[model samples]
Target: MADEVQHLTRAFSGLGGLGVDEPAMVSALARWRGQPEKRSGFRKGFPGFFSSHGEMERCEEEYMLRLAAEFARLKNLVVLWAMHPWERDARLAHHVLHQHHPAAIVVEVACTRSADELLGARRAYQALYHHSLEEDVAYRARDKPYCNLLVGLVSAYRYEGPRVNEEAARAEAEALGAAVKSAAGGKLLAENGDVVRILSTRSKPHLVETLRRYKEIHGRRLEEDLSGRGREETTTLLLEAVLCLTAPAKYFSQVMEVALREGADEHEKDALTRVAVTRSEHDMDEIRAAYEEQFGAKLEDAIAARAHGHYRDALLSLVMGAHHHHQ
Candidate 1:
């Protein structure tokens, strides 16, 4: 482990020179991709190793800037992939809070992650920015329904056990249906505490059963009911949260489809890199299968047609699990 750390330090040191050794960096990163202990060791040892020169921050900034100038997407991908997962998610949450339609990213992080992972992200957010994620989200989304929904999500710490109450789930499903119905009929969704409470507090298995009961009772999916009305931001956000919690693979595959479409703007296209990098080890195979089933084309083929050069190579490496190799 000590020798591996030293090797990684030396390999990363090359980034401060005139040009980046792309192959060397890729090889080192790939070797450590799935080795969580080694990556944790690298993070702990990096600052200590570089602090002697007092150039750690400068080197990182310069390297990132150079990469941004040449390959903006690659810069984002590399920075996110190299960080500890908690810090990576914290940074992503901070960034997307300032962008348009921040609901998707916020909901993704809140709903898709395990309870401990979400808590870790919140701790990292506080450590990095000196503010809690819930507080920041509340401040940014000052409106009634948006603030309520976003805050509830970030502050949640649901139970992770397999036990679920079918009776309570059925009742909660009715409550949720009533809330949506009231919201549609001119009530403020923020006033519907049942909606936020059930969503933010219920265990995943409980929620899944509730959603199934919702369809059984209401004769339609909750998402379908939400979309049958107009495309209000709050309604859309609610739909996204439900989909993320219930069917993450489908939600992610839909995001990738949008990112890979013709003439996609920078924000839209960035979703590809985000989803690929974050889900690579956890569930990339599920996402890839979902993508092919939904879009009727291979994800790798779509990426090859759209992305170019080393950016393409890095993304493919991640998506295909090539990064797990020692090289």
Candidate 2:
């Protein structure tokens, strides 16, 4: 870690103290990675130029290490920039599945639930990773209860029309309520399939109507009732997925609220990146409005208060419509 810090500090400073820009340094590192032989002489001579002071003797080794780390870091940034939004989301989802981190999976599914978006993401996954997204999820996501729910969500091709059958919504709402009630024990219930199918296959417009009917019929919000039962991981994901589908703007606003809060950690930074990159082109404007309405703080102001460096500038620009990639 100390070595990494030293390398990052110098790499951030300039390439070998030549005062080169980050872009230039990144370019040079790309070239070096492609042609390491070209740098063999410099790498060999690095030890000879150590400072006369013993402290300076360590500089050459550190410099080389820093160069390598910076090269990898910049390369990653390049890949991130080059990726389409769907590809980025696929990679993020693939990582989440493999690592067993399911917190953001529902949000990801919500963002891509529309027919065109989900199809594009699946294609992007195949193009980038040479494998189907569903296949990967089935293989990597070992936790059975939530895995089926996630797979069902991604695989669903819901009707996109706004025309919802009110009678059906009311009836299905009751069915869902009964399904939740049937899961009386803490153990997994067969009725969970009903919950997953209802949540996954329903259209956003239809689902919203169903949730409204659910609340009216049960005299409680769907999410609250789900939580009140305290079922399992699958149920938890179901609630989050339902909320994101029904009110994405408010859901994302709460995501940003937690991300920009004081004492936030790297997880917050990552969450901010996911939402900003994915939604910028989709519902960013709605998210921004929701952010201000819910938190009483402008999205840009909140991001500016918490972020810094080029990252901060990039985020601010995305939020304020200075970039095409942002929503």
Candidate 3:
């Protein structure tokens, strides 16, 4: 059943031969360079933003989809110029291309739902251009902390193409759990780190079963193992993200409430909205409470100030805070 819709779905910095002066794009970069800059709020998980469950409907209309379209068109252009792979300098140049073409980068990231397609577009760009896409990314991402994030996105720890129940996830999780419980506790092999490298697939059923089986075998839970590792925050995030890998709804209450209470502005509200739109498909009641505790305010009240109509109503419906369970 998961096979039906293959979900859809970063960079470095360097300078030189970026071709920032390429045609109409040169003018666009100049304008953006001229505008006042804004920070990436929340890093961007505003505190008290998610709850146990999440809002699910995409409210397709609500998303600025057209922006993504523009990015797609521009990314293709960058790829065209990248035919000759260069070193770090050229990679930074690629992002300069993105910064040069803000719309393209925004659009590409927003519309990109999967790492596979993202990598595909990247490879296509590399194949056409002489340089590897990674170089272009690194070059453009220079100095910005988000650079690592852009690069981190290069590969997926999860599987792609199909949600085949090869039990691949089960085996991997069990192996990881076993390793963690034995002599390998808190020890990651040189090879394992990226989600693309670890569990190997983002497919749902397979992952759930994997975690579940891991618990049965190891006595300790997957979350427990994850939280026990070094880099406490990263560990929590890793576990949470994995849980979200299959059940994004579970964290909605925490994400939304954080946004609304701490949001204090449209940007914050928009951030919460962004989180909710994606998670709405999951349970939301748990999310609401988490929000309340995290932000000391109800998620509904926060959104009430700015939202209206179907998109607003749909989210409210979820946050009505009922613990709706799936049959």
Each prediction's RMSD to truth: 12.4, 8.1, 18.4
lDDT tens digits, residue span 1-327, model 3: 111111111000000101111233333345445343311121122123212234322223323343333233224333433433222223333544655633123222312235554455566557556765656655665664334434544434334445555566567766676555552543442224434345333455566777777777778777666666665433443455555554444445544544445324433333344454433443455566666776677667766544432334444654563532322
Candidates in descending TM-score order: 1, 2, 3
Q: What lDDT would each prediction earn against the true structure?
A: 0.78, 0.66, 0.44
Clash count list over all predictions: 0, 2, 71
| 2 or 3, greater by TM-score | 2
Over 157-185, each residue of candidate 1 has an lDDT whose tens digit, in order, gives 99999999999999999998898788767
* Model 1 / residue 13 / CA error / Å: 32
Runs of candidate 1 exceeding 4 Å displacement: 1-70, 99-101, 322-327
- Off by more than 4 A, model 2: 1-82, 110-112, 187-191, 229-232, 322-327
lDDT, ranked from best to worst:
1, 2, 3
Write the number of the candidate with greater lDDT, choosing between 2 and 3: 2
lDDT of 1 at 109: 94
lDDT of 2 by residue, 141-214 (tens): 55566676677777777899879999989999998888767676554532377777877788889889998999
Models 1 onward score TM values of 0.76, 0.72, 0.41
Which one is best on lDDT?
A: 1
**What ranges in model 3 sit over 4 Å off?**
1-154, 157-167, 182-196, 200-202, 230-233, 260-270, 277-327
